[model samples]
Target: MTAAGYITDVDYIPGFYPQLAPVAMRHVAALNGVVPPRIADGFRYLELGCGLGRSLTTLAAANPQGTFVGVDVNPEHTAATQRDITAGGLANTRVITSDFASLPADLGEFEFITLHGVWSWVAPEVREQILAAAQRHLAPGGLLLVSYNSMPGWAHLQPIRGIIRQYAVLRQGDSAQRVREALAYLLFIRERHAKYFEDNPRAAAYVDGIVKQDVRYIAHEYLNEHWTSFYFAEVAGMFSRAGLSFVGSLPVHTNFWDLCVRPEFQELFRTTTDRLITEAHKDFCANTAFRWDLYARAPRAMKSFEERVREADDIEFRVTRAGVTLPHQTNLDVVTSTVQGPLYQALLDMMSTGSRPLSAIVADPRVAGTPPADVSRAVDAGVALGLFEISARHVDTATGEPRGPYAMPNDFNRAVIASDALSGRAVAVASQLTGTGHTLGDLDAGILNELVERGEDGLAPRVGARLTAAGRSLERDGKPIKDQTEQGVIMAQACEAFCRTSLRQFLQLGIVSPG
Candidate 1:
């Protein structure tokens, strides 16, 4: 092992994952009627193994009231993160280059601690240190978010992982080259009609998919010296040692038993009763390969069913997509369900003007007779389907006034939008409303940047000129338009769509103001 006692030569890729956002955790907690850690403002957040620190820096930009710190053993990663922080003018964030095992105790406590795509890839000693840090640095009632590769689903892929790791060790090259060699070795074995590959068709298919994936991701996932996938029960046990209790999964839909497991296993899950055992059984039922879990120093008691319904009533919902239709289908793991008809349509209609509290949605004339339970289920279904989003910002239960985190544009999003004017490659924008990031296409980002700078009148001309300068011409019916006049016409149409659809989403997400 290197002096750091962990693999450092092969750095993890820089990627932004919205699942790591504190708002996502709070949203899930709120859905369950449990009080989440107070992260609305003035919260200290820490991220272990924060590669490139994209999520942390973006979050810091959005929540200037909060303090953010990221720790990574790689100096190169830390340097890149520092550069990003400086460029974004984020004063509330910092990155440290140090192994988890040697993290300074004097760094102070944090209310929100996160480690994404790290636990299953690091050595056991490193994991021990991480848990130790959680026990020591996590303040009372703090939340710990950890994501890892989980089992039963990974059972079919474990042997493939072993083969790749073994082959990578013998190859001499950079991490990407080693990943290519390992994938080639697997392909060679498959070509020979190896008994292992013949016996496991799914494993062969997984190997085929891995061959096509980015080598950087492959190297971090498979080329690591130590990697282990855990069962849900096993992970729960490990966290228990650190004085943390598993609250629930980040995706609110995962907490709904009926939505995750097959019908046949639902009865078994109900009878199991124990949360840990039920989670494990659900994993087996769904063949779940990955999990984003939330743990707390002490789990708060959930409100009674009626009280939970009342709490849910005060929360607001917004349709993320414009002109969303019904007959929505939600597929989580192996479980799939379809939601249709007037109930969802009415809810969508109510949100068309702007975000409305669920109380208003439940009381709407069109769906006034619908049962509260049905409304809740449909809302959850819509959220899982990505047609609707539940805002982290809460409303005062009595007065119906906005409470908790209020939506506002932030420096990080402005920086991202400004950067898009030159690079035009960013695919996400930070959403202050949700305390998370939202995805947008390169064209949409370019148009938003131009609109921010030049306003509505200059939007189409700026976008068309940018596209022309980039050697990109608009396409229609699978054919590129090369004529200057035709290109301008298409660009105008594209900008109009952006104004109608993408711009509305930006307004809802708090990435930009309506004006």
Candidate 2:
């Protein structure tokens, strides 16, 4: 570790990121008509800079068939991860404490390698080592997912980062304290109407948002000694040296041209036949701040239109929100649009029942006349809008059996819910269906924890007691219930909603069983 001890600091918070899940990565690849590596059976998955290893541990628990390895420089992070793995009784995951530059040569190849929030935060030499690892260990057709702050979008915020870092270095305090001081300084300057803030008005909003973010996150993001933002073409060129070709973005929306770029720029984008140039132009148009890019060692041949539609048809989707109303609005930070049409409404209606495969949905009489490609596009749009979640077909390929409500309780979810209860801090819950973690709020975690301890027969009273202990009471029509009878009624209603919506979602995620 260096004298500053910054590189090996363990001050970072543990959190789960669903974007790094194999299901999510594979889904994005499939959206581009590329078959991702087989993760259903034995597959190697590695995450570099896996801080606290929360994401990898959750993935390992959800995906017992795959081997998961997380490497980080901080011994504290790796040790904490090992503790989590042991607690969870996970046999398929391990964490190693080693810097990227010194990664063991015999670590072997991986079907999927991810570097989340690390690419733009490390030194050039470290980045070179990461690429070398990818070059040596990324299996052919394997996906390399990397997320970083990108240029054009981050251009305005660069100066703020610089100012914060400079101020932090001169301040006499620990990382968190320095971060607070730095943010206060920035706010002081902004309030005083500094010339920098005057010229970059949007940057002020960025700083305001940053101030409200987790202090630890702000410290890691701004207090880092080395941070660089790149354009899509620039990062693409760097990966090209490692024989990796850009596949697609993890966010499915970016794959669709209409969703990413404006109408006027579409013609200009069409004129440019180069993929890199088109992406660069799109970045400028959308002001892309962060990117979750997927790269493959070798590009898969594009599937024919019929083949693509056939493959797409097998993927499953479920509505994420309840009681969704149309003129459905989708917000891509850069742009927001209302999706209003009979096709969208019909698709939403279909998903309201439960998880449905795209094939069955397209076969519905309401959309029977719609072409498969058009249906695929509509589904893609819906997913991008957060109206639906797409699960890769391979997630259920091994069973090859019709999936109904969960029949067997998921031990992983049970352990996770129990751990959350003991820790009194709820972050996320493991989702077996999607092979990822779903965000869990405190109340949901409390309710689920109570459900785990007391079965449905004893659920309501215990849950209500738990809520009452937490100073949360059942609400009816947005008003808190004080009367005992009304409280009972409202609690019953809340429990029903939990069973219908939250528990149903857990079932879909294979977190719990109908039994």
Candidate 3:
């Protein structure tokens, strides 16, 4: 085993987390009444243990103004990330292969630092090194995002982890093979009506969920000897040692009191402005199993309401898709409520047409007279509830034309399109418009490649050829279409949808362009 007690032989998956985007981090901070790194001047970003660099490379490509760096102990991870950086021709991002304690001294400070799966899966010593890195390098007012498995929810499942890990050690081969054996043994036990599974149905169901996950993921998740899930208060206490204060959690709604817990349990939070207490209480109510939490090295609360409004102006929001009606009622996990009203209707109306700055949406004549703060809250609520989305303005608000220099479907995007078309990995291509990755399914990727090769022509030929070569069959309604005419009709329908929906959106996001 590695000295750090991490899973090193099997590499982690390539995944992009939208919350790690610089624009998203800035918005979450501002939404919670904190001043973030100024957007106009740009900022530096770092991801400790950045597995495969999907999030890192995509964000760097999406945000030209921001410089990005990724550090991971795994050389394979760094090598793959660097391959994308070079092939995608991203000059704004770099990756370093080094464990946390031995990070290069020349590496400068970062305005944003994030660690997604690292916190709960490393040795205590490695965690100390992580904190040491943050204490030494996090710039003033910089945000640090740490996502990990949390307690209460994982409490019942702790025995489940132990059983798998124990089973793994008794078997042979590498982490992956061992995990497969362990998973099989556990499933065998559950199927035999073991007392533990019989007593805890949720845990039994959780085992079922585990078996369906990727073997690579299961290996890395459970095989690590240092796996530890933490309670919120305990985690906060540790970050405090590194001079970081927990500000708010992600999905935006977590920061709001009314949106955090059940309506009946809401009384439990009314007496506390202390986030530590509220977070613990909120966790118990919702039994939140995992969290994407934001913390700042130097917590800087906005000094005035005007400053908060100014922050909102730079952040933009829009309906997630065209014709999205505001839900008459909203549910934020355990918290459910009736949010329909004049302001909500006005919000839906204004954003339905295009992405607009929070200031602009709240200032519209329809939503006017509503307090800007209240309006901003509503916008955040919609985002949390999946009613709206956050984006970068790709057009001149006044001129109704493209604004920023459009360079998407670049060398990097081409490689992604080619890979995703065949792999069906659901990985995203970089987007300048959203300042994040835009993901498409296998068929959409095929359609995009066709558009890249030859636009507005017959579809089923090239796309279907790619599928057949990849050993995949073209299917409709879960049944393979062997007949050419039927396949042509289905492909035609898919072509219409790609153009009407995803293609149009991709054009706005600059993920693809006219060759």
Best prediction by TM-score: 3
Model 3 off-target regions past 4 Å? 1-3, 326-331, 394-408, 475-489
lDDT of 1 by residue, 1-515 (tens): 12233456766665677777776766566565566676544789999989878888877765667899999888988998898788778888999888887887688998889999889998888888889999998887778899999998899889999999899889898877888888888999998989998999888777768886778788888878778999988888999999998888856678888888889889976577788788988888889999999888876665554555444343457776556667777676667877678887888887765666656666778887878656766776677667677665531112222222222256676666665543534456666556666767677777877776666676788888887788776777857777888778877888889776666556555577644
Every model: Cα RMSD to truth:
5.1, 4.6, 2.9
Candidate 3 colliding pairs: none
Choose 2 or 3, whichever is better by TM-score. Answer: 3
Error of 1 at 429 (Å): 1.7
Q: How many pairs of residues collide in model 3? A: 0
Model 1 has an lDDT value of: 0.75
Worst 10 residues of 3 by lDDT: 396-405
Per-residue alpha-carbon lDDT of candidate 2 for residues 1-515, written as tens digits (9 for 90 to 100):
32123444426777888889887887787777786776655789999999988899888877788999999888888898888888788888989888887777789999999999898888887888889999999999899999999988899889999999999889986888888899899999999999999998999877878987878888888777878899999899999999998888957788777888878778966677687987888898998999999998885754664665454444578776768889978877666778888998898888775667766777788888888778877887788778888664323211222233334265556666666642434567676566778877655776667765656675667777777776767666767778977777766776667766676666656666555
How does candidate 2 score on lDDT? 0.78
Consecutive 10-residue window with the lowest summed lDDT within model 1: 395-404
Q: lDDT of each model, Cα atoms only?
A: 0.75, 0.78, 0.81
Per-prediction tally of clashes: 0, 0, 0
Residues 261-291, candidate 3, lDDT per residue (tens digit)? 8778788676777888889988998898898
